[model samples]
Target: MLILGTGDVRQVLDGAETEVVAAVRRAYLLHDQGRTALPHSVFLRFPDDPRNRIIGLPGYLGEDEPVAGIKWIASFPGNTAAGLERASAAVILNSMATGRPEALLEGSVISSRRTAASAALAAAVLASSVPETGVSLIGCGVIGFEILAYLRAVLPDLATVTVFDLDRSRAEAFAARCEARWPGLKTEVAASAEDALAAHRLVTLATTAATPHLSTDACRPGTLVLHVSLRDLTPESILAAVNVVDDADHVCRESTSLHLAEQHSGNRDFIAASIGSVLGAEEPYRRAEDRVTVFSPFGLGTLDLALADLVRRRAEPLGLGTRVPDFLPGPASGADG
Candidate 1:
């Protein structure tokens, strides 16, 4: 078995946003083509602490170099108070022929990048006509940072960013980082989430809110919202917009905004299309010029597997990961039993 740590994964993915985005696009296309197996993610929560959870997303990506894998990720929102990241994860890829684990990889980076790439791809497909000069981010965490990076990679015209966070200091810090990363970029720390949402046509909601806290009252008619946090927007907000999701069955669960919307309306009709479908359509998806469009992704497991496979391929040739010779017993060793 080969083990790749965070640094190894970072090295492999550095300056590879474009490639990661392509891999993510392919994964979504394959999924839309019914060439993938993606079971719903399993969430484990503690009775004492409902806000924290560890999720297991298992999936199979069927293509020329088929691979199956599971990503085990833990989300402890309180970790941020201790100056630690809110999420950490690990992924294991299994061989198809032997059904044995082939690689173990640090998955936080893979998870974040794949998620960012998915959002970027959706932006490119859904908001093709929308002006990309500026964007607004409601949360200023690691996910928010990665989303900005991926968005810049795909939308080179993106020049300004407006940000908001419950923690004003964090928002300021995020703005500073953005300015430092892109020298000429303009970063504004908004006074409120509503202000941020109203600042740009393209908006991202990546907060850690446990339940709905936002409405679309402040957004303009043509706003395109990337609901990455899943639970930030109210059900009414979700129903009011042209809803696009990664998977209807997946997102309409786990008390996501769409799930609440379903429960309130008692139907899934609000969802107009999935990201995969939008990407696979014969005609480019045309956004309503007079309605807000919300793209809510459930964080597909196949995306993680796809990127992990890419990392493995890159790291192997460079002799990066630590290879364990006897991670599993050989067939000869089992014969003795």
Candidate 2:
């Protein structure tokens, strides 16, 4: 087994956003082709603390170089208040040939990068083509920063973006980071999430709330929402939009706002199509500009695996990660046999 730390993973992914974005898009296409196994993510919650939970996503990406893996991620909203990251994750990949663990990777960086890439890819198609259209970012955290980093690569013409966070300090810090990362990129601090939502033609919801807080009243018609944080919008808000997701089956589960909307309506007629379908089509689908368009991604494990595979392939040439000669020992009976 090889152990890839956060720094190692970061080094591998740095300056590789375009490549990673393409890899993530391929993963989506493979999934759309029914060549991947993406079981519903398993959620483990606590009765006393409903705001925090750990999720396990097991997936198989089958093709010429098939690989299987599971990503275990934990989300603790209080971590930010304690001066720590809110989300941390690790991903393990197993070889198809041997069915053995090939790598154990620190996954928070991979998770956020893949997630941001997924959103940015959606933004490439869904965001306003007109330059300088307002973009709002809610929940100024690491995820927000990652999204901004990728947006800088994909949508450099986005002139101004408003930011909102429950903590004034975080919002200010995020705004400063945005300015440093993208010069001449205008940013404003919103008095509230509603103000942020209404201030932009493109809105990104990355808040920490486990339950719905946004409503249709906050959104304007023709707005494109990158709902990176699931469960931040009410079911009514979800149903009111022309929804697009990475995976409908994956997103429409785990009590996400979309799930609640499906439960409320007893059908998924509200969802327009998977982003993959939209991307894979020869011609773009026509969406009414008067209706809100939302792209809510479930953060596919196949993406994590793909990115991790990239890191592994890149790092191996440099011999970056720590290698364990034999992470899994054979049975004593093998000696007698």
Candidate 3:
């Protein structure tokens, strides 16, 4: 198997945000076209420490490439305190022609960028306002930074950003980065998540909370909640909003928002739409006057696979990534004989 390390992946993904965003958009379009199979992600929770959780997501992209594969990204939130990232992932691409593993890629950067791009794309479609209105970001970590960068790219009206993080230092540092990279755009630290939500009509939740933190009552009317993390909002909050998710099957299965809504309503019918429908133009992104709009994306495997495919294609010309010869050898030529 070709081993594309994290450094290689980062090199391949550097300065490729626009392309990554486009690739993720295409993945959502594939979903809208009903040309993809996105199964619910399977989670293996630690028996002792629930905070240590691993998820397995696998999917097949459409027939647009010379190859195909399933992506598996494992997330462990406790890794942060150890000075490590909250999650570490690797993506494996298999050749349909021979049914063999073609690439085993480092998935950290790919996962984060694709996730941010998905949210940015959804915000472009669903938000009623423009970048002039600005956006409030809750949880200014890795995902938060990426989202802010992409938001700037997709929404020219995004002239300001208000941020809130449990760690005040992190928020301040993020603000400094924004000042250096996105000058003239206002970046301030909010005292609380509520303060952040109230400051801007557009909000994004990138918290690592395994449970709910924000609620509908804390938000402003007509606000758009970009929920990139699975379980950042309460069920009451979810049911209160015009809910949009990446995949109905996947989000409803693993999202904390869905879990809370299910616990309260005893059903999964509260979801109004998946972001894919809006992206695919199959359904319009309608805003209800009486409710807020919530976009929850569980980070689809197809998105990762799609982006990985793009990275592999680019890295080839740039002489990036390490190659592993005979990763699958001759393949399973005569299996079950």
Candidate 4:
């Protein structure tokens, strides 16, 4: 199989946020049209450490160039203490005709950037009504930084950003870098979630926290929350908001925001609409004066494929990634009798 490392992936997407946003938009559109197939991810827990869980996300991105792939990603919060990213992933792309492995690639950038780009797209679309605003980023990690960059591309009026993280050093470092990268915007570190929430109507939860960090009590009326981290908000918080998910079926099964709502309410009816439905124009946006709006996305394989496709296209011209001979042979010569 052709194995493309992390260096290759990064080279392709180094400064292509705008293209990434467009690709994510297309993925959402395809999802709304029922053109993609994504099964509920399978989580395998370690026998020794129940907390260390590895997940398999397998799916096909339909609607042209139907690339099939699966990503195996592991999440170990303890990895941070060992000087490694909490989440590490690898993707395997297969040939449709031959059913053979074609490409093995690093999935970290694919995971991180597509996620940030998807959130940025949602923020841009939702911000139509609330254009003049600031963004309160709850966690300033790798994903958080990329989200800010893509948000700048989409929402130019995003003139201010209030950041908060449990780690003061990380927050300060993020703020300083953002100030330099985004010279026009004001970036500051807030002391608490409450302080951050109070400063901006657009809130992004990008922390690695295993439990809920923000509450409905902190969210302002008419605010739009991007729940990037699965378990960053409580059920009460989700129930209070006009919930919109990337994929209703997928999010309900995986995202903690949806899980809590489903657990407490004993139903999924509380969900307002899937963001895909909105993208397809099946569910129209209604402006409610006092309703909180939230978009929770369980990272979709189609999105990963879309971004990967984009990266491959860019890398070809830039000579960024290694080119290898065909890993998979053609279709079977004849069918069995």
TM-score (all chains, Cα) for each model: 0.98, 0.95, 0.92, 0.91
Which is better, 2 or 4, measured by lDDT? 2
Instruction: List model 4 lDDT by residue over 80-127, tens digit each.
Output: 668788788988887888777777778888989999998988887665
Cα-based lDDT at residue 41, candidate 1? 97
| lDDT at residue 39 of model 1 (Cα atoms) | 92
Stretches of candidate 4 exceeding 4 Å from the true structure: 48-51, 282-287, 323-337
CA displacement after TM-score superposition, residue 265 of candidate 1 (Å): 0.6
lDDT of 1 by residue, 144-252 (tens): 9999999999998999999999999999999999998998999999999899989998999998899999998899888899999999999999999999998899999
Clashing pairs in 4: none
lDDT of 1: 0.94
Work out how many backbone clashes candidate 3 has.
4
Clashing pairs in 1: none
Candidate ordering by TM-score (highest first): 1, 2, 3, 4
TM-score of 1: 0.98
> What is the C-alpha lDDT profile of model 3 across 54-162, one tens digit per residue?
6777788875663467666667766777888887788888887776788889887888999889888888888673333588999988899999988888887788899
Q: What is the C-alpha RMSD of each candidate to the true structure, in Å?
A: 1.1, 1.8, 2.3, 2.8
lDDT of each: 0.94, 0.87, 0.81, 0.81
